[model samples]
Target: MLKRKLLTYALISGLSFSMGSSFVHADVTKLRLAVETTPGDPLNIMLASFRDTLQSSAEEEVELEFFEGGALGSESDLIQLLRAEQVQVLPIGSDIVELDSNFAIFDMPFMFADKQTARDALDGELGELLADSLREKSGLEVLAFGELGFRIISNSRRPINTPEDLSGLKLRTPGSATRILAFEMLGAAPTPMSLGEVYIALRQGVLDGQENPLSVLEEFSLYEVQDYVSLTNHVYTPITLTMSANSYAELSPDMQEHVISAAQEGAYQTRQLSDTSDAELVEAFTSAGVAVNQPDLASFQTASVPIREAIAERLDAVFWEQAQNILEPR
Candidate 1:
């Protein structure tokens, strides 16, 4: 199955490049988009929609070639490639916060009451502020915001019903400093690791558990190694659709418009897919023998208050306030 998936993308890359080159009469704007995630992940889903929309709307004016499943390397390596213009676009994960701490605003635990509230902020000024900061700091232009969705903790140990339930469990988290601190405050020993390494670690007893959206848990097959899931709805992670500044500047104005509009469409599609897919994915986990529970978030939220204050000064003052205004409870 994995071999077939790789061969499919290889054909896509070759065909896209050939189509772009064969347009002798008209100049084709070629863009390379890479991601560490596999084809069916939400990040790739958004990019696939973005690519198709661009193709249909622009009609040979633009061609997008994908290098997915970490073909180019980790998200960190991909960022360096974007800066060097080796790749034109990427759907960057929370590792982006490492570039500019202001992006950490999205890493706050229990920040949004629901996915809709998170979408409202990402599609509004709060998102704009972080995007502008990213451009200034790293020269990547943000096109749209998609999601990694709200994360829930799953473990091999026990069903987590409260913050106390998390005590001393070595949980695998993404490489986000704020996220690490958030888990620590909730009483878990957070271990930072890449998604690709998580399954073996869980199965071999190197990790007690990890947190992610249900889609990710299913996509990565992490549920196979775990026994319990606690729907803490702990953090809402946004994947930023970004283009290299060099690539954007080189595009004709009309082509740039096509890219941006297509990105917005893809972003909306991802949110809709995530909203609908969770209910089904949850059942799949239960059927696989993984116990599931939706714990009351009040206790988790209470434990996270001090961590919020701790990271407050680490973020941009203005951006922090704006984020709170958009996502904080009414």
Candidate 2:
């Protein structure tokens, strides 16, 4: 994939754009979008929609291509490539913490009420706050926001119906300190691991349980191994679509607007798709025989108070205040 992109880079490098022009006809600018989910997963489905939308809306102005299911690399590897300008755009899930720790605000336990509330916070000023951090700290332009859905806990050991049930269970979490801390506060032993290793770990008894949205449970087929799934909707994670600032800078202002607008449309599509798919995915998991149960949500929410305060003290105060203002609204 890198070689193909490099070749395309060379081919387009010689094409010169005339300044003050509203559009560029010099060469086709294909925005290569990367994600770690497989073809049927919501992200890929959204990417296909993104491609069609970009083609129809900007047929001559630009193009969009996708390398899904970790084809380019894990989100981490892809970020390095995005920084190097090897790829133009990639949708990131939790790894946004690595880009700007302010994003760790999302990992705070039991933050958003539901997918719609999460979308409103991100689509409003709060989203721009994190986007500003990324552009300033990482040279990435925030194109739009999508949904990873709310994360639920699934286990092989037994049912997790409360915070106490989580005690001593080795739960697989992303390699984020905030996530690990969240699990610890909820009385589970958080095991930080890459998503690729999770299935094998569960099969080998290396992990007791893990958490993710229903789509991921379906995508990874963890339901095949894990006997029980506890709907402990602890965190609502948003997928971020972004481009390298340098790439955005190189395009004519009008073309730049097109890329951002196309990405935003794709993101809006993904959010809508996710909202509709979550209930169906849950029902499918239940039919597949994965024990699904909703724990007392108030217990989980109450347990999160100190965890919120503790992590907030560790993160940038401005970002924390921004989150509070958006969620609670001035």
Candidate 3:
């Protein structure tokens, strides 16, 4: 059995976790997994599945400590904890682009025709390239890529039927340069903030709109504050399950297999959940008295051309070309 020595205290975002406070048998190995998402959010669901899968299949005793709802802090803060070996695993969203800009490809508007196309590319060569770049640049292990689904716009303002309707509206987005630039090109004033701050900002009129997967509306109870739901379906983001290299390296080979297998299983469940949630949430939002509209995507797609072209030029030429080739019509 593989045994891990526990640190007495690990600090993250000014919070300390007592890893060694609890007694454990010498044969038990503890894994720390966290996400900044709410309890029922996709990221949290995936993490729970990973923990269950790993514990069920592992040869030795596996103890997992699950932290959710920004308990450890924001996604950025979680990344830092992983880097410091304070946290062993994290499921991160597009904020990961900050770690390696190569992931900014996900921020490109209208990039994926559908989830399958996006999944195909990510489960194939393009995924490998991005994973390799991240591993080489940051000593993290990319276990699996789970779906964040396609991002749609939600607003307290009037219904958005076209890109013109977004004009001058203050939209909250993650701190992604390409994503912000895309919204700017579409005529919205983009505001970058942490996920935890978005709801209050919208409620207080600091942001007129925000974009995220439909599940976010239900997960964060955003429907109460946002009146209109625009089916922009602009960007498809994937949450990556990443492990600290230090933690992964310390695992025995058999235990490492358990980790990888569990991650893949959890990722698959998230993809299925995203596909079903999109259709169901539309009806849920409408019943909640929110006006939902399908915007003129052609106009949005047309306006997105420059940003795509610009991102292609900024990214590695080989990766860009190969990603295009992999995502091309079959």
> Against the true structure, what is every candidate's RMSD?
5.2, 4.9, 5.4
Order candidates by TM-score, high to low: 3, 1, 2
Deviating ranges (above 4 Å) for candidate 2: 1-27, 63-65
lDDT, candidate 2, 1-330, per-residue tens: 687557444433422231122222467666666777787676676566667777777787675656788776666777776776766777788888888888888888888887778888788888988888889878998888887789999999888877999999998998888889989988899998878889999999999989988788788888888999888888988888878888788887777776677777878877777777788977888888888888998988898999988889877887788778878877
Task: Give the per-residue lDDT digits (tens) of candidate 1, residues 111-225.
Answer: 7888888888888877888888988988889999998899899999999998999999999988989889888888899999989999999999999999998889988999999
State TM-scores per candidate. Answer: 0.90, 0.89, 0.91
Ranking by lDDT: 3, 1, 2
What is candidate 1's local distance difference test score? Answer: 0.84
Query: Least accurate stretch of 10 residues (summed lDDT) in model 3?
Result: 1-10
lDDT of 3 at 6: 20
Candidate 2: how large is its RMSD?
Answer: 4.9
Q: Candidate 1: list runs displaced more than 4 Å.
A: 1-26, 326-330
- lDDT measured at residue 241 in model 2 versus the true structure, 0 to 100: 82
TM match of model 2 to true structure: 0.89
Best-performing candidate as measured by TM-score: 3
How far does residue 81 in candidate 2 sit from its true spot (Å)? 0.5
Candidate 3 differs from the real structure by a C-alpha RMSD in angstroms, to one decimal, of 5.4
